[model samples]
Target: MKFKNLLLSWKYPSILLLGIGISNFGAWVYFIALNLIVLDLTNSALAVAGLYIVKPIAALFTNVWAGSVIDRINKRNLMVALDLFRAVFIALLPLTSSIWVIYSVVFVINMAGAMFGTTSRSYITKLIPIEQRKRFNSLRSLIDSGAFLVGPAIAGILFLIGTPILAIYINAVALFLSGIITLFMPNLEKDRSLEQSDSSLSWKIIKQDWAIVLNFSRQYSYIMFMHFLFSCMMVMATAIDSQEAAFAKAVLFLTDTDYGFLVSIAGAGIIVGALVNTMIVSKIQISFLIGLGSLFVSVGYIIYSFSSSFSIAALGFFIIAFSLAFANTGYQTFYQNNIPVEIMGRVGSVFGLLEACLIIITTTIVGVSAQFISIQFVVITGSIIMFALTILLFILSMKPSKSRYYSVKSVEAKDL
Candidate 1:
């Protein structure tokens, strides 16, 4: 009876989780499969690298205006539409042999993805109550970790049986299924009324939204700082990660097989940590999860930065991956709790634009510096900067006066 009641309470959230898991699993499969297809078509490593650039480029173009649309529409319907849109584009990917056409299609798909990301964050905040967000995020983390491991394995099996094209079709099917699953979730905006006189987007409206976000930041400086600091940490992480293959080969003297094994170890770490996180999330403070978890993640990078062997690098991977679940869950819950749902889309998109720009700049600098200097030196410098940023975040998170931000108590969005 207790189990039945619990399941009934979580019916919608559970359904949403299923959709997210399916899409996430499909995403990984599509990523690996597409990379292989591109490599096979072009036979150039640089061409394979171009696929990675398409998403951020799409983000740079889309995020500027995505939040405006996301905030105005019915989120559930938009998500379903976006999923189907992506599915169609992904299905079309196999037919195109030209690299430019493929990049164009992928760019459109990523633009939909970026809008979907901001829409879902705002939608989740509205659909889930404040009290349940941490638990939901933890479970979501576990599902993401599972996909991280299983998705690639599934793609590999598909390759053995068929081809990369087959894997692409499978992802299309998964996304279609995800969209269908999302149709069952309740629409949060069914009873809500839009307060605007003109709903159509324009340069003026976007500028207004930007001003609103800036005003919110001014009013809630601490909250915005947390967001900015976390983004900087992620940018640094991405910069360091761009040189990971070079670091493994040049500094650690790891072969391809060893590097693959090390990645699996990190996946294992994520699963283990997420499992533990799901079990104990209710007992731990959100501040600790964000501050300490992130700090430990940086420590893991620091360990990897200084390591000279494959085993040591593997250890660093495990530690960082393990800590990521807690950090992500904590920050997600905190953001949902503290940010008013009304402006969440605008805030997320504007900040996301900055984060994307920083990633491009930081990654370019790291890559260029590694070419000029040493990979280890660039990686070590990036990691140390990340570590310092996290320490500041830790100190900020621990302030007694700011404890209200981390509380799990229910508060209305209007009150925020």
Candidate 2:
């Protein structure tokens, strides 16, 4: 479907897309300012790194039972509440000069973010039809990439005009605006029957919800395995990302402006890829979309790991970012289509918890390994691991996935 046609077909989806885009802008701006604050406060690279870990740590705890709460509540309300919650905390951030208080506020905001993510996905799955998910996801990818690209540039301008504190205040205002926009979207409350039957919103239900998710997992091993592989991809990507600036400057001898140009090209690549996907996604099989995109991204990173020239490295960045749009859209479509709609919140929270923990664990291992091993060797290993995993997933896609709820063959036959 054409992008214009897609937008015209839905009212709430467009609103949601615009809201999320704005939210992402706020998030990226806040992230940049927060990292700067940490570095300025402690004058320690380790402390800044420590601050990065705070989100994952908070997710590890919040995601354990977030599904329980998400399933029982109004998703729209939850999203708005989370946005307002985050806005309040973020607005309060500049009031304190204490590094510890900043950390505490950041952690709370991150927790709200984690819950928002799982709940929003569940809400989207319910609101958007299965056939249109690929398109919606592609649009989301486009907005997210565009937001990341624009947000930092805007933040930098704010810093130039005033201070990083000004950027934080701007983000808080953005969050507030996002919340107000969300209030205008379609009011999609859960089915009254489902909500009535669902367990009450309480901590005691967390254990029960987890058991439900575990049983659900056993019934759908293929889905869980794919999720695990995706987790690995995420971890490897994070590991490579952590060392990206260092490799770009220290190893490739690129100047700061050169690295900035490379990043801009990568962002442009993502937008281009998403644009292309919107045009071609309806004709492509999702398994091919995912498997081939994964292969493409892995190959790009492998090229990056070995490249000695700026031009070649820039090509790697383009390839990775471009294919990443496809991979992300494919995975999101797969996730939304296969999972039972009612249990989406619970299963998603479980997956989030697992992915968040794995990311931290893998990143820590890579960081420590870099201390003794050659950084180049560590990076190459991550690239190879990504390649191997993608290759395995591609091989597995030779036949239809074992998922009872959705199949690659069904995806092809339905033309969705």
Q: Which candidate is the best by TM-score?
A: 1
Error of 2 at 411 (Å): 12
Query: Relative to the unseen true structure, what is the C-alpha lDDT of residue 340 in candidate 1, on a scale of 0 to 100?
Result: 84
lDDT tens readout by residue for model 2, 247-318: 887779889999999888898888888888878888887787777888899999999999899889889999
Show model 1 residue runs off by greater than 4 Å: 191-198, 409-416
Our tally of clashes for model 2 stands at: 0
lDDT of 1 by residue, 1-416 (tens): 99998888799999999999999999999999999999999999999988877878888999898887777778888888899999999999999999999999999999999989999999999899788899999999999999999999999999999999999999999999999999999978875333332368999899988898898899889999998999899899988999999999999998899988988999999999999999999999999999999999999999999998888898999999999999999899989988888888889999999998999999999999999999999999999999999999999999999999999663345554
Per-residue error (Å), model 1, residue 86 = 0.3
Q: Model 1 Cα RMSD, Å?
A: 1.8
lDDT of 2 at 315: 90
Cα error, residue 236 of model 1, in Å, equals: 1.0
TM-score of each: 0.97, 0.92
Clashes of each: 0, 0
Q: Which numbered prediction scores highest in lDDT against the true structure?
A: 1
- Each prediction's Cα lDDT score? 0.91, 0.83
